[model samples]
Target: MTKGLKPTRLIADSSPVMKVPTAPAHLSRDAKTEWRRVAPILVERCILTIGDLGILESYCSAIGLVREASKHLQTEGLVLENGKRNPAAGIMTTAQTVALRAASELGLTPVARSRSGMSAQADPDDDTDNPLAVR
Candidate 1:
């Protein structure tokens, strides 16, 4: 919603209790569904906190927009009556981008997942976890 991007710092709670947040009442149906799907995993992994709700909500809302736009594109096709691009297509692209950004910040992406494990500040040179690798 702001003009530019803001930084996100994940404060982890190792061995956190499984207290998944409830979906907000203001979210669309699709957003609520997304929240239900994602909240548990984040909570179970102790990756989410009350402070992260704002971004989580944004992620869910963006995912909702993407899913909604996808339905429109499927039913109406990519072009409109005026031979212009479907607005939902743009919405999907932007929403997908936003969702991807939020997902990464939340450590939901494969690349980001590396940081989600214990010891978020692991040293790259530390191969202690790789017993089979050369020292």
Candidate 2:
């Protein structure tokens, strides 16, 4: 037999329906709230699958960290003794960056596609269940 490239086989309906997993028990209350807020949107848009729960938890936890860091920075001003920047300023910056990166990765940012080059295919006007669907 001659060596040649094999033809690719396409499976029908290979994309699995998205399912939202329960918030992980280890997540803090704020993290759980963030998960509840974001998970459903990702699931409805079919961006996240049930198997991606771990990554989802990590993203939500990062958001919680950013929130906590922001609170600390707000309560305790941006500078400490000797006019040095508060350590919490650095922590807030790092946490905010981490959270933003995670959100962009998950397509939660408004301009995420411009940065990540991943486009969401779902059309807002394509809902079949709505009797008053806009054309």
Candidate 3:
């Protein structure tokens, strides 16, 4: 008489590793994913990509013309309203906005220009001037 051994079946715990909660009452999955991606990038850049030494969270959240102006100054060292450091003005520029967010994250406190033609000079010593600083 021969004894037979039982074979074991491999079991896989086929469960999702991470379970994200359902989106908020209004946000769609795509919108949430988009926000998650862009928000982090914006936040990170604001914190890690500026010429100013420090930034307040309140200022970063400030939107509209004032916020755009503030970001322009903080990031590119350009006066938004006056075109002093800037070559032009009146319309808000996306390039400037992107620059400002980046600068904010980098811990730089930008000086915003006034609408009355008050202009400020750029700090030659600011790290943003050097393209190679981040890399």
> Which structure among the candidates has the greatest TM-score?
1
Off by over 4 Å in 2: 1-17, 113-135
Top lDDT prediction, candidate number: 1
lDDT of 1 by residue, 1-135 (tens): 669744233434454436887899999899999999999988766667676788999999999999999999999999999999999999999999999999987778887875423433455566666659876
Residue pairs with backbone atoms closer than 3 Å in model 2 (clashes): none
Model 1: CA > 4 A from native: 1-18, 116-135
Model 1 worst lDDT window (10 residues): 5-14
TM-score sort, best first: 1, 2, 3
Clashing pairs counted in every model? 0, 0, 14
lDDT assessment of candidate 2:
0.69
**After superposition, candidate 3 runs with Cα above 4 Å error:** 1-24, 47-124, 127-135
For each candidate, the alpha-carbon lDDT, in order, equals 0.81, 0.69, 0.37
RMSD (Cα, Å) for all candidates, in order, is 5.7, 9.7, 24.3
TM-score, prediction 2: 0.66
Clashes of 3: 14
Assess every candidate by TM-score: 0.76, 0.66, 0.21
